[model samples]
Target: MFFDARKNHQRLIRRAVSAALASVLIPLAANPAQAASYIRVNLIGYQSTLSAEAYLMTTSSISGETFAIKNASGSTVATGNVSATSGKWGSYNVYPISFTLSTPGSYHISVSGTVSANSPPFSVNTTSNLYSQGVANALSFYQNERDGANYISSALRTAPGHLNDANATVYKTPAFDSNDNITSSLSATGATIDASGGWWDAGDYLKFVQTHSYVVALMLVGIRDFPAQMGASSNSDFTNEAKFGLDWLQKMWDDNSETLYYQVGIGTDFTNANYQSDHDIWRLPQADDTYGGSDSTYQYIRHRPVFVAGSAGSKISPNLAGRLAADFALCYYVFKNTDTSYANQCLRSAEHIFDLANTSPGTLLTVAPNDFYPETEWRDDMELGATELYFALQSGGLPSGLPHTDPSYYLQQAATWAHNYITGPNDGSDTLNLYDVSGLAHFDLYRAITLAGNPSGLAVTQSDLLSDIANQIQTSVSQSKDPFGTPWAWGSSDTVSHEAGLSIMAREYYSLTKTGSYATDARRWMANVLGANPWGLSFIVGDGSLFPYCMQHQVANIVGSTNGMSPILSGAVVEGPTNAASSGSLDGMVTCPPNGEDSYKAFNGSGAVYKDNVQSYSTDEPAIDLTATSFLMFSWQIAGAPATTP
Candidate 1:
């Protein structure tokens, strides 16, 4: 998906001013009917503190009238004193006013002016705080999956053999720089990081988890959604596509795409007719003219080989090809719990991938550029690979010869590394060594607990740790507001831009302990960040690249066609924040999470509050991943879990 300026753009900055200054235009417009309109302020690159002149144009003609700017809740934050001076041709003056949010919440502005009797009525259409609301809904959906309710119906599950369209887009493509070291393409859209979108293929296992809970519903949906052609397709096509997919995976492995190849990027599978042409047919749900070609090298890397490989079933390595399923499980369990059968399959698969990670396939242990982590990194592929093994161990599949003690030792060692950092004694400082988001490394502690077998071993301590982290995140959210109460993406760091990761972390915390302020904080962050869009709606930007504006992809409207109804998980469902029914509105499009709450919240001993509203997508509301998380939540509900109150 792509966007043009008017289609998607916004900005902001703040500071103090004693004297009157030139008012900046709050460029805005709206459709005659129910449509949202607002002036976007770009604060992403703004300095931490500063205030400036702000204005709102309410009338078609400059005249002796005043307009006011209010917080999204309709509280007057600033009022304009009109000078009897004619302004621009068709703009009313609401000028030289100052406002600040220096806290967390949504800031909404409305301008009213006394206009000529023949002119349009005095009305300004806008809303705020919807971002937070949207996020809360997304989080709630996630919590449900984490607890064990299938929010995404299993009816959408891809039958066992073909590539699920949900996980079929290539986020990043394997290419070669002048050196032939295998460079990667983020996406043709120019987003070079997976965070922006493109190349996130691990969603497959997430659907699998959701399916288990909503088996009947999923089976039914699958029967309706899966094409009859898939059932009638030649069985050989499945094998062929599988092989092609493997070769593509191998190329990715050979290339240092990210720290891990991560099963990211669009998939090329020929088992089904939709994707089985002589080329790697990249089909999105609604768009026509599938991407990918048979050409070897182009301005960007090419997927033609993948297409050819799919048709021939000649390119995949048996060992690597066979391991894809397990890899999927490892990725899913990072946040989700798993069952025995899935665990066994994942274990066998992980063992092989670990081997492949450590050694070139068919070769001895040798470090390479593509290894998931660098040898120099505190925890490299060895520890990380072991971590996957640990999950597999918990799932009940013990590998043939690998001693249980070995994994145990690795977990212990990982704990030691984490403990050393958290204890902070080495730095001779009173603060925990793991004070920054770098401390996110501590997430591994959860992995260790899973491996410890005695969920009680570090359970109590872990709950405390999570609470402590949640508090810090809350504090960050609180301070993020300018003096008025609008939450900024981050207070001091650029890296901690979105709260998606934090939401995931907080939800995970709640899942583990169901105790403390975790749920409250999780809900709060969701409310303020992702859920509280001005229209009180939420959206899912597809797994493609995030645009330059930093906002998630905000769909103008839901698809109204059968093509739109297909069970595809791309694009976010965005809600406007200004709905009167909503508690409030947020400042941006669909709300997104601030990136580094884990680090900031840890240092501050506080996090944002929990608040939220509901959201709507097509009949296919939450994507597979979101639905899987909902299932997890439902599971917890069924068990009647207790909540953690700090």
Candidate 2:
């Protein structure tokens, strides 16, 4: 109904203009009408204040467009004019509208006069259930991203169910050996390795250790900080999702050889005719191998291989190993009480990997020639692994096979690593401060100082770490240039992860100093992500009125189609808009509007650039790490007790 009015408005404008003028202007305004007149609101709605925006479809600016906020009883609660400050989308202008609701109830927006449109219904409430629901939905995304032994829960099932594959046993190709060495030809003696489990990295089926490690750490933090919020009840889905990744990570290690696999597969060639055939076809996990056929048709699936640790050809990536160590150590700390033997195993493996990584420094994981995740930094990973190992040893007692008999040795290692990281380049200068593990390193170090009892007695004091963290939060707040206060960067998806990181730091800072400044800033950032941005659109799918319907994810796209292509998994956060430098290169991938205009122009105006089309992977792909980070932020906001300080 909203789209019809927008279309009707466009038709009348075309009829009024000259044919020559209409030819150029119509295409700009004639881009497909969105389902809700580009009215973006928190699909889950807001509580204290109701904020939303109406994107005008017309190029000519209408000054006094009457907009009203109406309640479920169809009574107008508030009225205002569309803001004159218009967001330019090529020739079209998107208008802004906001109003405060006096009561908590279901509501929608109605625009009269020049632009006639109605928004989808939403809620206004004081309960934390919305955020809790967001966490649950975000965790469900991992279930949907599962590669083997996928979650079959009726409530969480978004993808087609399948049998376990490549986990029990997987064949090794010469192109990619067990030790991750690259070769020109297939191996003479085919080998089988047990490489199964873990989640697919993004819309594509590849898995990277760098990203996986980041995700696992965030989940562990969620469980640690808000056990009740993360469903600490027996066999909770949150715990189960985290364990899924941990189980797969354990398999990646070969104890005898002291090696770990960085990634399991390669992204399909984007230029190929069968660019995403692996996803387009509904095959089991093991189907991605040569066992089924030797024909050229099967080549795409057959070449997927696991990259392991070793030399230049088979580089023993310290960053990957360090992250793996951190994951194991953190799991040890969390699961030690319930599962002792399993926890002990994780502890032993964590210490071993940490030592191996520290001793063998320069062996970086070489990015497979065609692979996308090439990790460039190792300091943060090393810091996190050491910190977790120190805490695990201190809390859970010593495990057998450790290099040192004294737990303090591990503590000392952790403190040394932390000192180096804090003094290193992880200050707010680099955007890496947002998505990278440096913030985690700082958070863990702060915990070691205030909560964990600074056992190592390293040089830097607790006050220094707290000050640096406060400065980091302030820098992030100041850097946000958008009207909605969401920070922008080269990668919109990475920016989401970065925003989550800032929230994590802000919460920790609040815990330490009882200062509400960072916490208040953190809440605003969360609101921005929800729907308080320039686009007034929630970056998260299925959580807001104008959420992303057509994300660049293949599984979601196909699974969503089963439900008439609405959204598949709720609470799946999409990578938001990026700047020209980042999006310009991917212009060829976008197919919307057909005319090769800036793909960034695809979103409703407000300069909140993004595209819902499947081809716009840069701005629409939902990633595991990003979702994991969001889950952490949501759990903190919803599950943790309300802040007592201002």
Candidate 3:
């Protein structure tokens, strides 16, 4: 999960005219069997103000080609010439094209030439129609991912799940086999705690604080940044959903005893076939509490086991401590005015936990089976924790339970950590996904320096910190190999979400710097996720006509249809093509792909091979961490992303 920070200009103020330009891709040995033309586009609506882009792919290359945007009634609304062909993609010659339509209505892309074809019907709509629905659908994904008594009204998911997580048993982390399955029986700690009301980490029922805390922070940050877009706290909106995760996090963090429980339930247990684990069972989540089977086999499923990070009062892995602290500190900001008592509790937890960060860290704690998450760095996590703590302290009063400490102390700490992150080996390693939060931390710290009247003792200057985020975008842009202008790598679909966040962070600094390169990046990444790609598929479910129907999620796979609309897992973003598929299945589950057929194999390329099958976790598994970024990205767009000047 590390990157070789591609070197770029030392300053973010440098014009990225060259970074914005891209070259054509010619598939040298691409097949030439298909003769017809195909138009690839974003099936979901685009913002009327932004120039919508698509790809015209055919078997033959040509000149003097013109394209038109036609309304639902087949009337021409906009026209442009495809003067420059964009080389080759798969077996087709590609022509990159763009058009603008200010009018809000349904439309389609059309080419009037020798190689003529029509794109799937799309829309040019308002930001609300284009993004708000996406955000709402994303929230539905979270709700469907929800655990315990509080539940949302969904067509497929009606019952509450994992209610028995309340008063869940505590267990020691078990040893795992090479395949990441538990090898033997687990030992209980002779204790119990209420560990209910969080999200299921992914397609599986097991929950991990490693993934949960990251989701909680993103939700809280969205609630803080886009208060208007998130809606009222009274409704089942972002504030309510974030608070749901926060409440669960509070349960995980035993403040009185300084204990941090990091995981719940066990993974696959193939070593002892008699014993079962979360992955070994593939049923709706609600069935666990009411399971009808031998207690010895289903005990782990019905009464899940919780795993603590370490013993009470022990120093925590900086990764967990930092994010846990940030989650609460942001909670203090979001609720300080309306809910003073709750905000104080959040701030108090933040103060106590941030104080216990393992500054000189070794092995970072991600999941019990480290192979599952494989998080490498910790400084980025701590930097965000300190910066948000500083923000909470900068806002106003201290939590009543804690001793008095100056806000400047945290500000300097944040700066020092930011400096470490910038100079550290992982400086430009990643963007704002669950693993790397430096993109977000840098954005806040830059402004926090000014709020503190440009403190002289800080370790990093505003210029150094801002350039780091710019470098992340620079790296992604430079590394882009996809015909859609997105960088591709193994397990890179979520990386698109991360890169989109980096661009949005750069845009958040626009009023201060007045640059627009990141704005274009923001749109480009969104397009890739929404649908514009070689396969003409949307990585996010329920966003467009053509999206994943057989996601590996239990709820979706059990009750959902293969047709993409029988109560689809709306707004769930999945991991995309890693050029390989890991096909799998369990008993009593709907069979996806019917006979292991590779439906889209003809379109497979060097690093991109996407499958919409329940067995394919590589291309179909939707997880909490994977979908977290989409919530923020969609909200930012729904709010117009504000500064649009280039």
Candidate 4:
């Protein structure tokens, strides 16, 4: 069951060296011969019950190929014939081979014949402990992405070169508005906010409230559903990670003025040179400020703008406010048992924001339009916020003198929101409907009606929600265009998020119906995210044999090496595979062609259009919401269903 970590590391090194040497020594003219002579198993290994897949690269079909799985003791424990499944990726034919391991231990696999290759040793275990390990690594990614004075401890740091950002203090003196217009009479002694914390939104230093709130809400839900799996104590990894975001969210809110800052700092589109200049610089967050100077260089500096309710440019957006309210309310519920005072503060803010959102309804927040995190729809956010607020009030003793505490009001609001978005006719197609937060709202309402024992005569019932989820899963599988059997589109991370979200829902459905297929499909999606793809690479970094290294994150790009040895940070899932249409935008950003372009010579044979380059933000940038949802999915998998469900 145990193997020396050092030996495994050494084996990886040897394989890398051998692969490099093979690439150099083998002539380009002999590519066809080399391709025809080797076989590759997509995964490092497989679980006891899962099917193992091996890929044979050849232009011509070969029959009767056999493969064997050997134990660490060099004994063949299982063997099977290679049955061709699909061959969409160039000349490679995928053969799915099945095997079972009753015991938990390390093992290697080999294909029989003249063109055989041995897989590196992998493990098989009965317990869902891999999911736990994955959660830990995913949480560690937040630590690695931490800005300000926080430094990841040596024990937890996967990429040691990624040091803490020295800049913690951020003094905001806005020179230009969101439209690049100069602001008249900008303050010299601007609001000195300690915007030292929060994970970067994606591939940039900007911290967005829209995306951050969604992530925080999902993390809370994960802990609530799988307390044991998520280690729901105060000092636990899940709680710690949630706290990092909570602290940042709290800082973003100015309680005295009842205003929330949607985002901090500008993105690359503002000024490419200034954005790139932050690289390799060890300075405080305050160093970017210009102290009300009219200099052009100072004008290009970052700005931290706040949105006040009913203000000229800051008219309250129901969705943005709803998201903020939900985030705070969930934080209140999660931390109430551990830190009462802090929890009360969160509840107060939640109520204030909820009231503001409910009272003022027009168009969503029109403060700024940053393509990075646009708030296109607000109904989902509104439903999620209402649902969370209802739950928080139900659990944390409804506070006196609060209109938002009416359980019937919130329940009806949530149900109406769900009806408008999810159960409506315009829910969109499977591929087009990438990331839907409305599902979470539906799930919450369903739980309220059944699990929480709340009373509401809403048209949306528990059975209806479950049926919709099942249909969505079926649609995803039926609509997938890839050989890997997972749906993908222009933005692959949306597919990744959708899968993770579906997995979370499937687990809940399994709990209600005791349906085995739900769990089976969930596991299949997880497998695809881990390794079961045409590229044979895990989208999650640092987990599988082949994973992302050159993530499009700015900090990671500056700190990590280029050869895919050191990832931006371990356990971070990048924006996954995109279609060929994305190549044009990516090509304009980087000097070299991004890795997965169809026109790229290397990818021509593989049919892969997803890239891991730093400039390929559409595909390779890691985002907070995706990480949060992925954490939820992994936690649900590890928790599994109760032995005897009601």
Q: What is the C-alpha RMSD of each candidate to the true structure, in Å?
A: 16.9, 8.9, 7.4, 7.9
Best model number under TM-score: 3
For each candidate, give its TM-score against the true structure: 0.38, 0.76, 0.91, 0.79
What's the lDDT for all of these models? 0.27, 0.57, 0.75, 0.56
Q: lDDT of candidate 4?
A: 0.56
Where in model 3 is the C-alpha error above 4 Å?
2-34, 233-236, 270-273, 488-493, 509-512, 594-597, 641-646
Q: Who wins the lDDT comparison?
A: 3
lDDT (Cα, tens digit) per residue for candidate 3, span 1-646: 6521101101000000111111111222223443557777877877887776788877778787898989999999889887577556667677888888899999988886566677777888887777777788888888888888987768878899999999899988788877776777787888899999888888878788888888888888777767666747312278888888999999999998999999988765647767667777678888998685666777878888999877888999999999998999999988898899999999999989998888888868877777677778788888888888888888887767674357788888889988988888887767788778888788778778888889796899999887887787777656655555664343354554564565466565563576766666676667777767776767787787777767788888777765664577888887766556556567866876555555556666656667767777766677898888887887777674422210
List the pairs of residues colliding in candidate 3.
none
User: Candidate 1: global Cα-lDDT?
Assistant: 0.27
Q: Write the per-residue lDDT of candidate 2 for residues 475-533, one digit (tens) a residue.
A: 66565544344544322335565676677677777867776666665665676677654
* Residues 8-63, model 1: lDDT tens digits: 11110001111211011112333343111222232111111223223222334344
Clashing pairs in 2: 43-544, 43-545, 310-314, 311-314, 317-365
Q: Go through the candidates in order and give the clash count of each.
A: 135, 5, 0, 2
Error of 2 at 27 (Å): 17
Q: What lDDT is reached at residue 643 by model 4?
A: 26
